[model samples]
Target: MASNVAQFAEGEDPQQMSSDTAALQDQGWALDTDGMGVTKTFHFKSYFKAVAFVNLIAAESSAKKHHPTMTMRIGSVDVHWTTHRPRGLTHKDIDLARHCDRGAGLMGAVESGQGIKCGPKN
Candidate 1:
């Protein structure tokens, strides 16, 4: 989907980032308000399933060597992707976000389509 961005390079320029962000948004990801990352949350019926989804993402990130920050709760997992080297979102982040969508689907997670939400503070 989204014009076969499978081979997209990392650290794409600003215009390219905008295009990639639009495509990713169509797939249920949203750019963080701070303009540094993209994030989406997936919901599960059980804590075990949520953790399983996180595990799946962990394995994929490890294999790709592009890790994401994952937050797991009782029945959800939020995935955030950004490239630190270039100091902003990039094609790598978009691709990984797409991969996470597919991976979560395979694991039977119901994608929220609501972007991100912070947890309770200490």
Candidate 2:
């Protein structure tokens, strides 16, 4: 469920940030302690699944001209979103964060305890 998402034209607006990030938090996202970005970790059953989730986000990022810094682990992908041009969290970041969640689900993401360790379960 991709949406037409865009970045704000200015820096972080504290008043707007509160409401903007609250819902995401409920969905397992973390607002950066530095207050510059948001992050979430998605667990998967394999490294391939983890990488696939990154590619899914990449496609969405390319479509929106907005991207997140993603670190793919053996069985988890860490996604961090922020707008450097406007120097803060934007609607783009929020929207993409949600997209990451969707993509994770589509990739068959598992819970942290169920994640693949080396490659596959024996």
Candidate 3:
């Protein structure tokens, strides 16, 4: 059976999600209090790379039908994910986050100072 994020509510007991949150946070994601969202920052060596990454994320967001609030600066990109319809966190948010992480990982992006690359090496 698939897990439903709607089963959880904001400001309620987050014990069940503590571990997941910890893991994601360790990957450089943080919670957005006001938006009830999660955010992650990615640093690139150049402005063009940063913007390209942001564009990649934007394309993915549109494909997923879940959009994140993004801010792209010279050398950094910040992405915040949340469920705008219900106005809080959801499994969709978490799933989308993981997808974003995977996409970043494929591009040789670093998260929390660690380089992440997806897929097994043949």
Candidate 4:
């Protein structure tokens, strides 16, 4: 399991997040900024594949004791990761995002799409 807790000092800068977000994006992960926490979405080819990807993420998140909001759509699975208790993005979030990226690659899913689309209102 990837490390859910990272060495983050207080008052992390948004620019730092941009850099990390870019890195994750390059690896086929979508980053969401229009919320209290960071979100990412991964696309697959079929419902079974999508569910399988979610299961892998579930195991990883459970092992870390950190969870993400997950959604299953036609041929896709969206995962939003953030440290809600603290109300901000953290290294843990980025780490999980990276892990999700790796899982996507392992499953032969290409990360190519528009940036995260805001989910339904509230």
Candidate 5:
């Protein structure tokens, strides 16, 4: 809903949205119970990698003019994509979610168990 994004762009149709959301869900993204957005948590080997991933996302979002809500941690980042203007999921959301998957891979994202955690060691 930023001035940079197209004001006329709208959310996807239910049918098309189903398939689009499904693909992201298979990649670990979860559809919001309210059916308005999608979320995923990407893990990394170190704090540096995690921060790098966030930066990667930031660059892409800026270029696309569609930003996501990101919560960064020592070894992970939780990303939620939703079109505020459209008030639901849209093509931009789908595209950006896929970009996130690709970026995470490039950043050496790891499984939750394998990721570095900021806490006392066992």
Candidate 6:
């Protein structure tokens, strides 16, 4: 099931954030306390793998024209997505967040707290 099956219109009301956040939560994304963005951290076994995953995220961001704020660690990456133009979350951010999760899975990256059991490729 695609996490971003829903689309939001420009200037959508904040009321929709509840449902949008719920869908993202199921996919491992956490909403910021301010309710303005969603974040997720991906873990890898090596720095090289982490960098490779970041590259995939970059490509996706560029393709969608919706960039995210990223923090790279030795073997992990934190991705925070928010639509800045209108200053809140949007369908684009949700869709890109889902893509990030899918891309991370394909590259053998796992969520930060999931450890080895969550490694989809293993």
TM-scores, all models, native as reference: 0.76, 0.83, 0.70, 0.69, 0.87, 0.77
lDDT of all predictions, in order shown? Answer: 0.74, 0.80, 0.67, 0.67, 0.83, 0.77
Ranking by TM-score: 5, 2, 6, 1, 3, 4
Per-residue alpha-carbon lDDT of candidate 4 for residues 1-122, written as tens digits (9 for 90 to 100): 22332323346667787678667656655445443344556676556677778888999999999899988775677787877656666777888888887887776564545222335533
What does candidate 1's lDDT look like per residue over 71-104, in tens digits?
A: 8877788788877786777777887898888887
RMSD of each: 7.2, 6.3, 9.3, 8.4, 6.0, 6.9
Candidate 6 Cα misplacement greater than 4 A, ranges:
1-10, 13-17, 111-122
Model 5, span 1-122: residue lDDT tens: 22211222364577777777778777888876566778888999999999899999999999999999999988889998888886777888889999999999999999988999877999
Worst lDDT run of 10 residues, candidate 4, spans 1-10
Query: Model 6: per-residue lDDT, tens digit, 1-122?
Result: 22332333368755675676687789878776566778888888777888888999999899888999999887788898888787777888888988988888888886565433324564
Worst 10 residues of 3 by lDDT: 1-10
* Reference-based lDDT, residue 119, model 4: 52
For model 3, what is the alpha-carbon lDDT of residue 3?
A: 26
lDDT of 3 by residue, 18-113 (tens): 556566777777777553678888866556667677778888788888888888765567788877665567666777788778776655565443
On a 0 to 100 scale, what is the lDDT of residue 100 in model 3? 71
Q: Against the correct fold, how does model 1 do in TM-score?
A: 0.76
Q: In candidate 2, what are the lDDT values of residues 36-104, reduced to their tens digit?
A: 678888999878888888889999999999989888888888899988887767878888998888888
Q: Identify the candidate with maximal lDDT.
A: 5
Poorest 10 consecutive residues by lDDT, candidate 6: 1-10
Clashing pairs in 3: none
Candidate 3 TM-score, true structure as reference? 0.70
